[model samples]
Target: MIMVTGASGALGSLIAAKLAASGREVVAGTRRPTGSARRVDFDAPDSLAEAFGGVDVLVAVSAGFAEDDVVIARHRAVVEAAANAGVRQVVYTSLTGAGEHMSIAPAHRATERLLAAAPFAVTVLRNGLYAELLSQAAEQAVATGVLTLPLGGGKVAAAAREDLAEAAARVAVEADAQVDNAHRGRVYELVGSEALGGEDLASALSAEHGKEIAYAPLSLGDFRAALTAAGLPPFQVAHTVSVFANVNAGFMGGTESDLPGLLAGAPRRAIDVL
Candidate 1:
């Protein structure tokens, strides 16, 4: 059986659904039992053990970003449970530039390490930034006619969440015979074909919405204040600001083969998604 953890999440839910629709024996793992999914919580080891029984392939999605330590601990719990259950392989949804000192990098890097050292074969799918953010930015721009963020001249090679979910589904179903053994214990950076800067993003939004959208680059302090004013928690504000900083430092942009290879076609452009 193939198990997709974090089934309630945006990406995980899609992956589980896709795998199920494709006729795979899918077990959706969530914190609550909804429909066909089994209830499994990271803080609850018994739940994990119960949910993981008889599972062959495991799709381990990252925990919620409520806290870094909490996320890492939850990921570790999943790794331990997978190891104990004798899962054959694990496909992890990690972040791009996970070891590059970004805001959420440490937890992802640590989780990758834990998965790598596990008895099972591990595939680390380092997903790029989501284009859904750009979609949201477009909506905000429609209201204000300005796309404002702390990202300076840097760019993000982002793909839609659905694209990543499709990749995860394939990873879950493809067997060792179909996939090369060399891909095991390797990291695949999933990214879009092209990088998008703020101006480029604004242009896309303007074209899509038929509005005079403008890109407003803010100071880091200003960006944090904006997020704070928007009622984001202190930790989230910090995390978001740090992400923008990394974007400025060029950590979020890359042209990689894994994403297009997984899709068997070019990923949907950010503007199209917007």
Candidate 2:
């Protein structure tokens, strides 16, 4: 049996559905799952064990927003449960360049380190930034004809969420088929073919919307002020600024990657996502 945690979430739900449609025995793990899905909460140990029981492969998606320590602890619980459940192959959905000093890297890096010590084999999917993440900003840009953010001139290597979900599903099914531990301790950086900047994004958006959209770079301070003025809470404002800083430093950009091959063809562009 293959179990996909966070099945209520965007990527997780997609992965679970795809795996099941592919004729794999899939168990959906979520806090509140419908239909035949099981309820699994990282904070609940017994629930983790129950959800993971009899599972041969485990796909552990990253926990939702929490403090760094809390996130790590929750993931530890999942790892322990997977071990106790006798899962053979573990697949983790991690952020791209998570080993680096990006804002969201610590928890993911810590989880990867923990999984390294597990008795089971693990495959890490270093997924790139999601293109749908920029939809809100893109909608605002379309409304105002300006793509204003604090990205500066840095590029972003982003892929569609559905594409990432498909790759994760494939990894799970293939691991089940082989079960030879060939992917043990292996990591794949799944990203888009092209490294995109704000200008490139604006062009894609303009082409999709049939209008003239301009890229307007803003200072970090101005960006924070804009976010605050837009009614974001302090914590969210801080987190958003930190992510932009990482983008400014080129943390999200990559020139060449195996994403196209992983997708079995050319990955969709920003225009398709828009």
Candidate 3:
């Protein structure tokens, strides 16, 4: 039986749906477990028996603020629950740089450590950035006929969310956990075949929409000014500008291992994702 945490989230729901469709005995777990079979909720240490009565595999999906301490605490709790349940396989949907030097890597790294000492065989799916996140910007490009962001031509090997979901599902079902055992102790530099820069992204949008859209490379300060002019809060605009700067500095994207191969196919094209 496969149990998925955060089953209500976009990627988590997709994973559970795919597993159920594939005829796996899936336990749809959420904060509120109802009439659903094999359901689970967040419970205290003494409540293990009720929380994990019949689960065989565990899939951990996290959705919350990216605070490292909070993330680490939740992930540690998840590992403890899995260990107590004596699950056979443990699969985690972690961010791309979870084991590297990115600011977002610490929580996942701590989670990996907690799981490594446990008895269950573990696999970590170090997922790449999502191309679907570009939809809003893409629609704006199609609307205003211009593609602009703070990203200044740095390339990102963005993968679709579906590809990452498929990989997670596959990780849970594979017969030899050892194939991903090295994956447990290590991080996979997941990426798309085509690394896209902000300039190239604008071009892609132009090509798709048949518009005269062009990339607008702005100074970080100017980008913040634009966002501020658009009525965004100072804090949010600050965060947005900072992230784009990071992306431009090549932090959110990396390329090496082909993540699509883990799903046994090529990733969905960026336009298709759009």
**Alpha-carbon lDDT of model 3:** 0.70
Clashing residue pairs in all predictions, respectively, total 0, 0, 0
Give the lDDT of residue 46 in candidate 1.
Answer: 63
**Predicted candidate 3 versus true structure: per-residue lDDT over 75-133, tens digit per residue:** 77777777777777777777666225555556667777887888887777777667876
Q: Whose lDDT is higher: candidate 2's or candidate 3's?
A: 2
Better of 1 and 3 by TM-score: 1
lDDT of each: 0.82, 0.84, 0.70
The 10-residue segment of model 1 with minimum total lDDT is: 175-184
Off by over 4 Å in 1: 176-182
Encode model 1's per-residue lDDT on 149-263: one tens digit a residue: 6779988887889899998887777842345565567788887778899999888778877889899987888888888999998878987888788878887777764787777
| Model 2 ranges off by over 4 Å | 179-181, 226-236
For candidate 2, what is the lDDT?
Answer: 0.84
Ranking by TM-score: 1, 2, 3
User: Which tens-of-lDDT digit does each residue in 1-274 have in candidate 2?
Assistant: 8999999899999999899998878899999888888988998877787788999989999996677787899999999999998999899999787226566688889999999999999999988778787788788999999998788998887788888998888889988877445566788888776678899989988988899999998789998998899998676687678877877887777746656666766788755786
TM-score of candidate 1 relative to the true fold: 0.93
